[model samples]
Target: MTQRKRMMRVPAFPNNAKLFALAVVLALFLAPAPARADVTKTNVGGTDLQANVQLVEYETSCRTTESDSDLIQGIIMPRNPASVRSVYFYFPGNTSEDAAVHEGGSDPERVCNPNTDGKTQFCKIVNNNQQFAVVTFNRNDAHTNTDNWLDEASDIQCFLREARTKIQAYNMNPSELFVSGHSGGGKQVAWAVANGGVGFSKTIFWDACYGTQCSSTAPRDNAGQMYLYYRAGTDTQADAEKAKQENSLKTKLVETTLRHPAIPNGCFLDPSNNDLCGGRGEEKGELVVGTVEPPFPLGLVFDETQLIIQQPQPRITIPGLQFSDPEELRQLIVREPDGSVYIQIPFLGQYLAAVYQWAVAAAGIIAVLVLIFSGVQWMMPGNVITNILTKAGGERQEESQNKAKKRIAGALIGLVLAVGSYVILYSINPDLVEFKSLRIPYIIPKPLVETDEPVDSIPFSALPAGAPDPALLPTAADVCFPLTRDSLDPRRGISWNWGSHRDGSDSDACEADSDRCHAGIDIYSKFPGQVVAVADGIVKDIRHVSRCADGWGAEGAERPGDGIVIYHRSLGLTFNYAEVDEGTSRVQEGQEVRKGDILGVASYCGMLHFEVYQGEVDRFQTLNWCPPGGIDVTERHQCATQNYPRPDALANPNDVVRRLEGNFCR
Candidate 1:
């Protein structure tokens, strides 16, 4: 489709002296005077239409910190503030380094002094023939794009507060606000509506409504109306079509979305392949005329003579509707806990799957035939009957019958055992066979195969019901010590000075600066052996954390290093060990471990920092515990001793060391 050509006449403004005088007159009689707005026609960004640019002073609540600036300069268009019935707000795409972080240009100013080089998506939107008062904002990078501020509810409130005042000032209805954007800006618009409490009357997108995230089939609070103008053959179209596939949850979801009832006339706009609809035209920048009907209703009257310009392609909208986020679309794809994604099979696939049941029936018939043949041979008097009929064949027939009867009997027994084994084993643990669905048509090609990655099998049920008997404990020759290749005592290069960095420290020995101090000991092994779990437990977590020694390497110099934490539910304790050699962890998280099982090698700094906490592992916080001091926090865990209670307060490991003495070489 092509755009209708029209000669745009740039509005002329009065001289500076006359404008100054008019400003003074308005200030004295009307209301508090804000910066005077100006009307100027200029080429903005990459648009073919000469945009009538205007300016409005705006400020929002978003900032880097409480002390930072909140001022924003909004770029507007058409110059006439009074003629607009609807207010359209837009966010710009990714900004440059100079625009994202610097505060030099952040002061309040007239919005059209080209705060962003005048080359932005907002410029293209504001330049359109639409009569709505279009405005776009400028914020620092932290408040722009994916910094989370775009999704913040407070930021939206700030914008609406300022927008409402501006709309009222222009004698327009604030509630008639329409929000829209291009690309990243569109994402912000969707996120803002879903999370922010403000309800916009309408939303429009320009080749930006994307992914399941930007469009939704459900009604969002205060944001139930929307329109999408997208390019054909774009990723956005792919996502939309995917959502509309047969038997898809999104197909049903679209039905529930807000829609306009059947059109008064059966003719809806077709926006297919409207390239000239959204691009800079030929030399002299004149809009080319196209005869195609606009895909979406152009509610605004353009030049009383013409009703069309190149309109955007693939126009779609849910009428009387509000926009919703894609995340809100439930049942789009059902996921099982085992990490398999599934969808209800289409009718054809279901029928095909159901047809496989005949195979199972055929196998059952074979088993019955085998049983019948064996019974017939066993019941018949084969040798005696054959001898009466034919003397020569009696001996041979008897021998053949005996062998065949035995073979048939064995085959029948094997078939019974095979079927019985499957039933029994499946009843015991179903994970061995991962089925897609338990519904009818239960026979289907497997839906998906989780990676066949081989992993160690250590089921918790396989562990002894209680702690093993003393005789079952590993001897010195069977296991290596944590601090040494041999014994764990001081004479064998191990530390006996336990709790060196805990409560007794006078600030020098503590690794962490917090009041709790370091809750466990450090094992500095010169020739460290493989670090092993001291008891049956589950490997809870594996992380790479920075190793900071005192104040050195405390900044960015510190980096992620290997670490592991195991939870021993039987012992009511959790053990965290760090500084493991890279790529040496043989066990994965959630795997069960037996006593003295090698967890990983101790490498790099040769210093393994270990900490033990009581009770279940709190995945959120891994703070070390300390003895009850003069600290004001009442919930602080006391030192692991006889004086403190069990479970909440950690237990000392001096006794645990003694129990593992025999497992380490002396």
Candidate 2:
């Protein structure tokens, strides 16, 4: 472990600070390498993105012993002083390297920290002495003997401790931390959000969903702190469609913030049928924000400075785009790749067998007690053993029977207690639960799934020719939102996106994009107060989105997918959230908002939908917060916000607004 600890540290010259400075100087003064850590640097940026960039690294203990100089790595990307009121951590995708990691089983060897080996991964730290910090440590565990490859959430917690230690020495506030991740990395974010402890408040998901990693028993985040996103697009027929899906997701999540739900902002997904997440990648930026128009933020630019320091992009001829569609571009050739499926088979079987054996052992113990009872009962003729009991006087035979019965009862009680103790112990420590669900039942040893039958069971058999044709789809619990005004709780307003399939409301019930009816509604102040407090007093803890609709317009709506939140005094009351078809905006803390005031419009899956919190909080059984009729619950739909546009790009802000006026579903 000690040796592993040393491996986790970032490598440096004689002086850590000076060496880092020198490394920065080298990158600033020279060319970037094609790869990293064969020395301690990464080639950052590409033809795709650019921005102010810096790469910093941090680590934790490896499992290897102290004496050995060998070890594995831990990675990090932190926002120096946080910004955008949140943070994101992208997870590495499934690749040849991951395939190799899996091939090694659960015990994938931990590598030396990249910084130590002279390799670099980019880390962005803001120079401000801000009070909050966003740490992104996506667990890179691919191999190991553990049940699940544990992401370093606990380790990250420990790292936060270290950060706090630094803060104490430097006399800074212990800042709040938020975590975000994509793909499998999203799973790590989910775990951290649920268990990341106090410093961590919410999560951002990219190209992922709860799936099984999010346990059913797990509590749902009600404050709207938890957000999920997925995006996909089409081909020549639909280059713009990709942008819509991404916009839609961001819109939905952003909208959720109004109701003060746990989710902060929906994910930004430029829809593409590409693969997995449909080509959501950029070499840079906190949010890959840019106007489809002009004066794009520098954050939109991909920083190549790091690359210039190492391997400069070669003038090598690149292959032409071969994909016919976004979907085609994303196809992966999935080979078993020398890795095991049902990898925990052996271990799981042992656990089951152990459990069964233990049960049988208990049964045997019960049987022994029964035998003793039987022997006592059978000693009817006053055998010496029996007489010893009946001795003094003519002890009643019935008394002997009663005595035997009591003994049996006592034995059963003891057995029950013993078993109970074992259960308690197992609960406290999972090591005691010796059972595993490693393999699917009837899994073929050298297995394969038959494709002849067609995997989608019903497939999209009777579908329209070009689009998804609305033919297929199958697919949370503890969740909340914001109330911006003194008007009635927005949550009591219209429920967005509660389509016929998922929430059981018909699509017709949803206002069409062409329809001017604000799809979501505004819950008016029941008592008409300027500052209507949420039903509860804890409203202070919530995080909220602060964008005006006019500023958001279509592009912001399509891009950010971000939302905001405000806590309530009551447990269940909430406001309405309707995503805008606009651009993302910046919001500051403690800004005063009015009752029935427009918070920010959300950019949800192509519509302005709203969810409500009127009934019980069961994940499956509640109604949406959308108000009656097609009226936007915001009371007056266009009353609250103005749209904001990205500075650069060819788009005319006026045109975007004009299109959104009609297209704005909310």
> TM-score winner among the candidates?
1
lDDT of 1 by residue, 35-98 (tens): 4453333532233333454445554444422225435545354555555665767654444355
Q: Cα miss at 341, model 1 (Å)?
A: 37
Give the TM-score comparing model 2 with the true structure, all chains together.
0.27
lDDT of 2 by residue, 249-308 (tens): 221122111111111112222211112122333211122222111111111111221222
Return the lDDT, model 2, position 665.
11
Could you tell me the C-alpha RMSD of candidate 2 in Å? 28.3
Whole-model alpha-carbon lDDT for candidate 1 = 0.41
Error of 1 at 487 (Å): 75
Which residue pairs of candidate 1 clash?
3-288, 3-310, 100-141, 223-322, 223-323, 224-321, 224-322, 225-321, 225-322
Best prediction by lDDT? 1
Off by over 4 Å in 1: 1-52, 62-70, 75-77, 98-130, 141-148, 209-211, 230-235, 242-666
TM-score of candidate 1 versus the correct structure, residues matched by position? 0.28
| TM-score per candidate, chains pooled | 0.28, 0.27
